[model samples]
Target chain A: MRAWESNIRKVVPYVPGEQPKGDRLIKLNTNENPYPPAPGVAEALKHMDIDRFRKYPDPTASDLVHALAEYYGVGDDQVFVGVGSDDVIAMSFLTFFNSEKPVLFPDVSYSFYKVWADLFAIPYETPALDANFCIHPEDYYRENGGVIFPNPNAPTGLLLSLEAVEDMIRHNQDVVVIVDEAYIDFGGKSALELIKKYENLLVVQTFSKSRSMAGMRIGFAIGHPDLIKALNDVKYSYNSYTMNMPSLILGTETVKDDVYFKETVQKIIDTREWSKTRLTELGFTFPDSMSNFIFASHNRVSAKELFEALKKQQIYVRYFDQPRLSNYLRISIGTREEMEALFAFLEKYLAQ
Target chain B: MRAWESNIRKVVPYVPGEQPKGDRLIKLNTNENPYPPAPGVAEALKHMDIDRFRKYPDPTASDLVHALAEYYGVGDDQVFVGVGSDDVIAMSFLTFFNSEKPVLFPDVSYSFYKVWADLFAIPYETPALDANFCIHPEDYYRENGGVIFPNPNAPTGLLLSLEAVEDMIRHNQDVVVIVDEAYIDFGGKSALELIKKYENLLVVQTFSKSRSMAGMRIGFAIGHPDLIKALNDVKYSYNSYTMNMPSLILGTETVKDDVYFKETVQKIIDTREWSKTRLTELGFTFPDSMSNFIFASHNRVSAKELFEALKKQQIYVRYFDQPRLSNYLRISIGTREEMEALFAFLEKYLAQ
Candidate 1:
């Protein structure tokens, strides 16, 4: 190692899902929305004057923030915008998880949670999920520096009820509680409704999953004004211009088209429901997920074998090699034709 | 105060130059490029497929990174891109400045350096600049965690000699030395050539000032492969997809047209030279600037009064209220016509 390497802040980075190049595959590993973004997004981008790009973007991102605040019926101060939910949550970890006590979250949750905690040198403890891959509210009731977990949680795609989410928040009122709602728009009710009541609660959502703008990189948090102010303080101190021009303009355009937003979400939900029935008939058992992805384990074939076989056919799905999760595969809900292709490949491979 | 507020990472955020709304105003505060970006940037955006935005942007920003590396004649592994240079330098600070010893820079350098230090809890000491607002190589010869200073330093626009920069880097070989070349394209030569000799040196540049893409938020750092890898690791840990799709694509296009890039830069340089003569004729004095902006203090009028007087007429320039900078006004070079309007206004105002 080099002498200067000794002072380097070493970190094991969170490996994102593979963005395989070329368009011949049924890409499903990353739980991205199968539909395009709101049509207004395309219209907005087409007419955007690139000349204005010579100037710096609005650092406050007021237009997008106001759009989100109006859509969610919160005050403008109650929202914070970032590159994505990853950026927003990472900033939250830095801003609110500064106490000496260990922050708490579910073991089976968005994997980035632990990475952010480690990167920031914040002590954290992951309480194991119950046998059914469900988060127990009582597990988070203990005293901690802060709390955070994804709703309609990743891999399992199971969601905690609003009351349970509130129960955890009420118990941990002394510390900040972040509800990562990346997958909330699929079917789950957002914890945003509870923000007015809980000063320490922050509900984060993204345009990546349901809004079909992952490539655009927009995410936001709706919380009490105090939490929002603190997040902004740290964000500005770090980088004043985190959200660029196109994102600010196009993200605002996204919020204006509620019809397209709802229709796209419903289509994914419909596809997911249809997929669950087909998976059950094929001898798969898994949680009844509310998110845009389904997690399943076949009755006979090992998930590893299935994962490799599917990869050979270019029908990609997420398979965690970690303990307990090795048996399951998380399949994102794609278009009907794409799902049919995946099912066709699976039926033939399993029979063999 | 709320009990949870104690855990909040409270910080005094850096205030950026005001981007006053309205096109009627002549904006010259932020040192942004005076011209639009390469024509290819518009062509690329016009043909972009918004449908592809449903997927996540490339986490590595490979196309843009490779393009930059090829353009700069560096290996692909030696390049790191981010939302802007602020994001790039912020990540560098997080990745490389983790030692217990205090990092060192000129006291009058980019104000954001101190803000990043405070935000990350990295101890830093700012040595005083010389009477001429120039960095002395010997002042940075002592022990510290790291060193960073802008070339053609901000709000002063005074360029340090390449030999002086190399001397400082040679002395601080034990720790990372960052030469922020934000305004390097305007006149000063980059320290990038020295990277082959010094593995500890990192050169950061931004398209915001020269390539005319501040709104698109494109910035990059070129250094040794190891340093680049360390920056990527910390960046991934912070936010996997810092550069969104449009920025990745548009930034790549901006790099392809070298002719347009050079012409735009030369235009700004010519304007700066012309403006300097005019400002001198009007009884303003400043360091010999090798940047897109000139930092000048009027002989008789107070900078605050001039700043306010200019703002009333819709011509904006930056004025610092802090000690030492209170008398100085940093005026960014705009188009020749815009500069003419500014001179027209100033000629009468100064005479009065």
Candidate 2:
């Protein structure tokens, strides 16, 4: 190893759910939407002026930002766009959490939080989630440099209520509070409504989920203009063209088609509800899920056994090997046909 | 304005040239390719499966990386792709220049270097270019944490010979030496040949200038497997899916068609050469430029005055208002008709 290598802070990165190659596998691991994006997105792609790529895309992505602002009913300056929610959150960590005190987050929330903190050498502490995999608003009331967590927490589709989120932000007024709503459109209300009440609140969301455009990598942040300005300062110092033209063009089209977005989201929510009842009858236990995925533990079969068994039959679901989550499986709500195939396998394997 | 704002290192970011909206003007501010990308790119965009965006893109970007490796005759592990060269160089700075020692670069080189240094808290020193705006290889022999400068440096377009570049890297063997080759294809040999011999050398290039894909935001860095590993480690920790699928798919098509790349680059070079002679005849003086853009100062008119005059006619070119560059204009070489129009305007204005 090179001597200079020591300068890099050691970090164990967060590994996302496996993206199975080819269409043979009934993939349901990463919470991708089961429906295609808005029809306008496809139409926009079809008629794209490919020659426009010869010039640089607008750094601010003004048209997309304006579309997002109009859709959300916020001021134009209140919105900020990036490559995806991952990028928006990473930039927020760099811009806001600079104090010597440790930042607070749920130990079982999105695992990328700690990775970013370690990468930037910022102090952070992950307070354990409650035994039921729910966030306790009181846990974040104490002093910290900043705070962040997914609303409908990953790997455990439990969402914190809007009132509880506001309580947490209200208590931590001195520091920035970033509420990641990557899955909010599935059911829960967004923290966007709370931004004006609390200046430090930043609500982060993405087109990767409800809008079904993860491959395009479009995400955004909504907050007070001052906070957006700070994020912009850091972003401009970093890569100015984080959002490419295709993402900006198609993302705007997707944002403008509210009817298609709502219809598709309602379908996923319905599918999630139906899957919850079927998994219960199959002897699985989980908190009531508010997201497109359900986090459940089989009453009889070990998660590892079920994970491997499904893989053998070309079905994919996320199984965590980490502590407190070893017995849990996060199953994304796929099309009705895909879910039916999953339960058919479960009925034979877990004869309980 | 805020108490925590003091923690962020204050920096004035590099402002890229304006991307004029509407097709009513002749655009050439940034050094973007003046021609459309290879025909394959348009074909790929036409046939792109918009429905494929339901899932996340491949994090590794295998196809594009392999294509780039094959084209450069390097192993796949020797290449690392990112959003753009700005991103590649920014990541390089964060990964390699972590030592307390100051890095070395030219004072009048790409202005983004200092902005990145300040943003990341890396100490850097800019040694003045020689009287003719040429990099003196001996100036880089001194001890520093790292070294990075464009081959044909920005705002000047004067190239340092490959031998001179090799000497600088050899002397600074302990530190990483990055050769920014954003304009190398216009008319300069690359430092890609030095990677196998020097493990610390990194050659950063972009499709923005050479391949006419600036709007897609594709750039790459080439080096030894060890250096690539270090960059990958930081990248995985930062954002795994840095390159979107459209870019990954379309960039591969561009790299495979080397003939189109050569034709477009040669066309720009010929236009640049002819433009240089005309500017010289009009009493404009500049070092011999081997890049797609020229850095020239006219004896008869102030650059700011000419910049406004050009803008009045909707002819755009980059004009820097910084120290020592206030009097110089960096004109991007556009199509033949566009350049002729520029000269036609200049001929009349200079006669005054």
Candidate 3:
């Protein structure tokens, strides 16, 4: 029975990682920053005018967009904000990936990419990453409708060079090329500086990772004027108030306080390096991750066994049950104390 | 030259009401609640833990959904929430309006309806309202892919009876029928109670009006489990974190405080009655309004001239430059003091 459902909308929804309740767990499933947001976030939330809820927020989110433009040294028209990177990327797909040729992406990129393609009825193909889980520049040189891939790609956390990104943009000059930089602040360089040269390039980023505001749900895109116009066109038609009051006000503060942002991101990178050494001692191997999470597989014990064992002790880490990632776990870097607890538990289990 | 644009996404975007800054105006253009949200809203903002922002919000919005479900006397799965009514309605078009047959709606209704149809490439037809600016049940008796219209329909605050709504559903049981009740709390009856008897009925309401949380951006749909399931499937496929922390927490508190909600709604309704009497004495005529706004036309003055004159005095009311509604102004019921000022201005202009 159709039951009032559209034939076009019978989609298998993208499953977000578990957000467990009890505070007892050392959660490392989703790649969230361990530190709190900038000091201004608390001040902003505290000083928020609750009375203003009677009126609507500015539909265009001009203040935040201007702040982003200023911070990135770009024109005001270059910036577009949304609920999250998920929202930005989803809108980008709707606006750009509509030609007859199939858009090309990595087979093992963020799972939501394929979901958006299927939902929008856009044809797509996934060129698999190499054996080391690295994106090959040559793979994206072919003709396509559009191209999108996460920089410092998720789970594996491998960063392709800025030079390689330039090659992909230059080759796909006829199509829109999106550089999803959701995890850029932790280590990898940003593609924002290249937006001036590549009119077809769109760089997408989120406050959920480095700025520690995943609960706030703020994300943005930096691109050329014409491409951004197309995005704004579709977004306005879809929903005018995509960015709410809290996001618009608080997100501006996040961009304004760049000193605190640098400190938080540097601290996370420090913790990640320390965890790398600890995991090696425990007989787990992973790539030199540039993002907030590390994708590792145990050399001795199966990843499934380790994932289950960690959950038993209330130390949660993500385990993909698919073919390629079935043997690995994507573990978000936490505070030093939380990482210690994870190592202590693994030490016991490995000894057994 | 299309300039790297998608042929499918060349949309003429919907233009929302102007949100003017620098508070020199008495704004009644959009049907936003004139009062602040519940008292608990301010306290909630003050006490929100900033540290929790590092983590993502609950994707399902369980607490808020549960509160709405409990309030409406429906199962949890029977409720669906989104960023705003615009978001909910847009998703409904994408999720439910599938068949090749054109969906039917009011020829003079909320302008966003036609915009959504154009954006999604869904075929739609606007059946003409009767000369009295009231919906005729017989107009919707024919076949359609789906149907949607606001209760106490916008720009003309006249309502069709519950029986009329049921008639549309009864006639179109094969498709979904949406009764958008954005201003129902002001005077009109809710169709939420009819959900139990009619699986095809989806009642959409918003916190932006009676609840006074437009800045918070919360709206919901009440329907049978299957219809609600269809909404969720598309929502999850689009963006998981549509509702953020502030919206979820504040919206939940709004539902819990029934006393405040009743008081605010009653206050608005009382003001609406008072405004009706004053306008009658001034030679202005209108229908018996069942919503917060009054659709009025003066016997002597041109709507265009009045609209321009009000703008000069920093008093704003909605004026559509379209057929049938071109002669009328949609004035939202403001506080007694604000309404008194509007009356003073009009009285002076008429004496001239």
Candidate 4:
């Protein structure tokens, strides 16, 4: 590796879901919201005083942090914002994990956690998820530097209960336990309330999925004041103005408009339930997911073949090449119309 | 430190210039453009289709890169964009500098370079600038892993000639030499053209200074394809889609509008020249600047005293605590009206 840093060469980078171009496809990947953000968000962006953008944005993202704190019923000191949840996670790794002690995470959860651990040269332990793809709380009680997992874990879409999250945090009092609630708005209780009780709990969320602002790139974490301070220190040391002005303004407005969030999330949940029922009827076996996506596989059709077949029909879905979950396809929940179109394409492709 | 990474504890972060609040003051710090971005930038941002923000931004920022490539007269493959030029520099440290070989840069250049080097754990040697506060290219030709310096460099607005840059690159063929042209548009030659000849040359520029999009946070580098590929690999391993949607569109439009860029740079340069002459006539000693700011001090006034005096007059200027530079104040080139007000206040203060 030409004498590069040992960590840089050894890093296994995180691969985000494919974002293919062209408007001619029924795209059901990356778990992005099918609908646009709230009307208030667009209006906020439209009315942004571009003249003020010449000034550097507030390093604290003060207004957005205040808005999130009020919404989550936590004090402002409990919150921290970044470019996105990915940035928040990166900051967390730098803050908590070290070369000496290994951080712990679920084996089949968000892939980025492992990548970040490697990039930071932090030793890590990936405790296997049980056969049904559930995270056991007791496994995390062991000695480790920190713990992180997507609540409604990616790929599997299986969620750990808030009680389980509390158990892990309570037992692992000396280490930071981060709950990445990127998809919690779709389902699952947020561990935000646990911040008051557990100094080690850091709940991370993003505007990308349920808020439908992936292109905007804003995310935040809620934790005890000490934990938040550690992250802020790392962020300031790295990049001061991590969140841009437009994202900050739009993110603040998105949090303020609770009505839009509730309505949009309800619609996605409805569509997800309907899609799961239809897939079951078609003899597809998958986890009963809490997130805005489903993990499924058909008995006769291989996931790889089905993925290719759908691609030929101009319908896109995500298929993993990793072991344990290689046979399943992770399908994002789209709008009712897009889901109907996907079913129609599947019917034709299956018959062929 | 409770099992935290050793490197995390050792990081002494970079401090960005102050972003003062309230609109009552004549803000001249932070080297921000006194003017808003081009009219087209505001228009592009105002009419942004929020729905487009739901999908991920172009991971490679191809459209922005292409537009920048065209403006800089380089191939798209020769360009790399990041969250800011700081991000680009950070990525460069990861890609080009090896831990075994020490990196080299000016001791008085961008402070963030040292921070990046430290964060990456890359050993670096800060070659001292001459007593005149000028960067001699020959100094960087010494054996090192890589070298970088801001042209029209920060704190002191001195610049190096393109010939000197070419000489340095010619001599240091084994190391990557980056010319950070952050303020090049003010009145300095960009080394972008040399990328075709010197494969080791990397030219980094930002939309923050001339284009007035600091709030949007976009910066880019023009380099050989291999160097660009290395940056991309590091970026992908870090956080893909570093630039958000509004920045991509606005930055692309701003880069293409060369007329606006030229006019803005001319206005700032003219203001800087006018301010320098006025300061000199008032018995202020300062370097002849080639950038959008003036660095000067009066024999009668301590830099800190002058800073506080100006603050009392609702005018803000940057003052650093670093050795040799502490006696001077760095004042950003504001609009003609703002500079006149500053001059009026200084005249009254100096007379007293």
Candidate 5:
């Protein structure tokens, strides 16, 4: 290594899914919403004062926070916003997971968890998930620096009951417990309801998946004011202005149009149900997904072959080459027409 | 303290300039650009397809990065983008300043540098700037973990000669040296040209002051490909999608309008020269500022009294109550008309 290289923080970053530029391909790899954001988001951008670009945005992000608080029926102090859910969770890890004891999560949770832990030098332990890709509440009951896990966990798309989630939180009341609810709006109930009861519990949600504003990069956390304050302290110290002008204005606009928000979510849920039945008919088996995506393994064809075949046809889906996931493919629910196209290709490819 | 609070990364966050919402105020506190961003930025947003909000923006920020690369005449691998210059510098601290040896910077510099050092648990020492608020080249010749300082230092708005900046970088070849050129476009030359000769030198700049996009949240770093790569690794590990779609697209449009960019920078420079004559005539002393703002102290009147007096009239300027800065007020150079309004008030107040 060069002399200067000796002190460099060497890290293997988490590789996000490919965002292929071509519009012709069906993009289901990143679990993005197939629908557009609220019409107000478009209208807000159109009418925005471009002259304001000369001034700095509000570091407190009060406008977006207030809108979120009103929608969720929480106090304004309970809300914290960031560029995206990744930014929120990363900030939480830095702010809360500083103890000597290992932070805890599922072995097969969102891959970014381990990456954050490593980046911050926060010791972490991952207890193995059970055979059915379900988290065991007892596993997180032991000593830890903190706790964080995705609701309706990624790739597996399996969710634990609310009681189990509460059990984990109750056992680890001495440390912060973050329930990342990126997929919660898809089907599962959010832990936001329990924020009043547990001061250490933080519920994180994003506009990326259910709200169809991933490209806009809006995410937020709701918790006791103390926890939110701690996160904001770290956030302000790190970067005072993570949320830009368009995001703050447009995100507030998205929150105002709850009717449109629910409609798009219901459409995705309906498509997910229909896709699940079709996948079963094609000899695929997987966990009952509570997320926008389905993780499936066919009894016949190897997942690698199917992944390559799908890619060759300009269709994109997520496939992890790691243990316990290599044989499965994670497919995000697209529109009915898009799902039909996926199914048509699968039926022909599997028969061959 | 609460049990969970014991492990919280407690910190005193950097307080950014107050972004008071009232449009009636003659704002000149933060040193933001006085003019709006390139006209093409508004045009791009008006014509943008809002349907793309459903997908994640390019994590690589390719279009913006490529635009910046072309403008700077560097390879794409040599450019790095982030939410703002603060984010870029914070990421650099976490990436390049990891050795046991303490990093070095000016004693009185951008306050956020110390906050980041404390936040990341990186050892650092602030060598005092000369009594003139100027960086001494010899002070940075000693062994260190890393080195960083704003080119035209904040609050003081005094700039170091390019030779002095290069001497510091040459002496610290074994460690990374960052030249924060946030106000470079105002008058000073950038250390960016030295990136090819010294691989350890990373030059960071922001569009906030020069290109007029503070509300949009865009900043970039140009350095050797290796340094850029290291910064990117940490950035991705922190948040893959730091640049949202609007920023990516609009920032690119700003870069494409070189004529507008130069015109605005020249306008601010011209305004600064004109304001200096007026301030001197009003019996104030200040460093020979080469930045968009003038940091000045009155010959008789107290800065605190002047700050409050201005605030009462809805004219905002910055006053730091800390050591050496208590008597000084940093007034950003506004439009000719706005500066005349400010002079009108200062003349009446100082005479009284």
Candidate 6:
């Protein structure tokens, strides 16, 4: 209808989770860390020399990549860093898929995959997840240019095991299989180790969730040298200085503080387990989750009604409008006190 | 030869200006601010509540857009903010130029323009600049889908007059014309006022130069509502959270402090004038620049030789390997003291 290209016009666009204003609510809509980043992150930021900002940040976040490589037990050449996991995924779409071949992903997976496909005019096929909302490796055996899926899938919070991931990669030898481990550190195993056997495997992770630096925007992918090179080429051709210096420093330091990372992730996993049991007692039916969030619903209480009730009680949670997810609420696991408040509010609201 | 998409496999990406590490050198290589940012900037950053970072930034950067719109005398809908001007330019390539038609730009202008064209696999033509290294409006009148050039263009620091810009817009009614005003606040007249009259015009600006927030990464574009919509479509489909919270805050405050901005611009202009007169007297053949940098060379001193000599004296300026620009060195205007240091070093180097 406008002067813009038809491909851009056709894009439905991905809508990110709402960021509500006001301090009146206990926010849990987006799956962000409930706790502050490691003390080292703030210390690193506080002492940053303002003069250094005058120079451009390193084009390739070299130090961050090296740190990531060390953490994941990979070579430095196997890593590619970007603004965030979203940027990494977008770059992957640009790098691996072209108009000639179709990219494959789960229909119920990250919504941005479809948006990127439409934006780049890349042909794509969305393989339907099984009836239990789990991706079957056999379903992705078709001739695809590439395959990508969130390890602990958003909105659902279900994780695929390492064996299942290996099966998909083994079946799709020609295509790149990207394991998006945005929330993997919370409970699941990363496919980073699988990269040694599968040349086309790219394991993507973010500091947003585990490191609790979402606002700082840092993410990276570890893969074979060739796969990393493809992503680097795409990134270089697009925007070279994607990650700023402060973010690189923060991310690098956060990765090195293994004590902080392990303690925080364990804390989230413990909270998630406790919350799941409590939700079960409240007559909620939800999938077993491996991420820092839980997806659940009850037949008696509508998802929208519960969301509104929580909002009224100063407790906020995410509710989707899509068909499969419309009746479910995706609640990000918060601190012990915050979860207690949520449970107390839910108990009162349900009794009423 | 790479395992990238065919378009990206052939991409010889643009190399950004050097951002050499360590504090030993007098850095004038990149046209960054010689002075530190507004005092409020660092203070604001220090006091930032790290807790607020858990939530995603406002995807639209609504408050920053509002402030920028107000400063530019336009509606919020007319503005589009991104990570930096580079991101804005990347989005523009997707939004404005279709692969069927060739985009046009000055041959000697910003190198990133061609890089974007190659990345997007869009056909492009480079119109030659005039003998004085200035953009000739008539040269862009050919049948093209879009045209872009930095006002007070980079490397050359030569500016096209506002009237000349209007002439190009008038002649090319059917194509998108992006006027990059990254250096306009330093001295050149802005084409922001022309956006209302010309539906195809998009004026891009950055907070990196005058505002001294290059490390923060914030840039924006102003245009008619429809053109802005096209850019938004592309941005939404690509990466939605391009601008982070700190950047939005830094950019908004920077624009709001009009007095600080004015004083900084005036000081830079004064220093540039003083430096230009000195260069002239010292037998340098420099372009009449409207930018924060000067383009100069001397018959007696080869640009490469001068560059090496300055390096030996622990000074840094940019030298290009491109044909026309090979003989010239682009020197960023620094503080009075820094300029004096540069002059002293130059005098000694030249005498030797």
TM-score of each: 0.99, 0.98, 0.99, 0.96, 0.99, 0.96
Candidate 3 structure, TM-score to reference: 0.99
Give model 1's DockQ, 2 decimals: 0.87
Docking band of candidate 4: medium
What candidate 4 gets wrong by more than 4 Å, as runs, is A1-16, B1-10
A best-first ranking of the candidates according to their DockQ comes to 5, 1, 3, 2, 4, 6
Each model's lDDT comes to: 0.92, 0.89, 0.90, 0.84, 0.93, 0.83
Per-residue lDDT for B60-149 in model 2, tens only? 899999999999999999999999999999989888888788999999998889888988889999999978888899998898888999
Relative to the unseen true structure, what is the C-alpha lDDT of residue B21 in candidate 3, on a scale of 0 to 100? 73
Which residue pairs overlap in candidate 5's backbone? none
Order the candidates by lDDT, highest first — what do you get?
5, 1, 3, 2, 4, 6
Q: Score candidate 2 by lDDT.
A: 0.89
Prediction 3 global C-alpha lDDT: 0.90
- TM match of model 4 to true structure: 0.96
lDDT of 3 at B104: 93
TM-score winner, 1 or 2: 1
What is the C-alpha DockQ of each candidate?
Answer: 0.87, 0.66, 0.74, 0.51, 0.89, 0.50
Which wins on lDDT, candidate 2 or candidate 3?
3
Q: Which candidate wins on lDDT?
A: 5
lDDT digits (tens) for residues B1-352 of candidate 5: 7899999997986677788889888999998888988999889989989999899999999999999999999999999999999899999999999999999989898989999999998999999978888889899889899999998998788899889999998999999999999999899988888998999999999989999999999999999999999999998898999999999999999999999999989999999999999999999999989999999999999999999999899989998989988999999999999999999999999888
In Å, candidate 6's interface RMSD is: 2.8
Q: In model 3, what lDDT does residue A28 have?
A: 94
lDDT of 6 at B23: 69
Q: Backbone collision count in every prediction? A: 0, 0, 0, 1, 0, 0
Give the TM-score comparing model 6 with the true structure, all chains together.
0.96
Kindly list the per-residue Cα lDDT of model 1 for residues A212-259, writing each as its tens digit: 999999999999998999999999998899999999999999999999
How well does chain B match by TM-score in each candidate? Answer: 0.99, 0.98, 0.98, 0.97, 0.99, 0.96
**Model 3, A1-352: lDDT tens per residue?**
7445543367886776788988888989998889898999889988888888899999999999999999989888989999999999999998898798999999988989899998888999999998999899899999899999999897799998999989888898888999999998888989888988988999999999998999999999999998888889999998999888988999999888889999888888999999999999999999889999999999989999999999999999999999789999999999989999999989988999
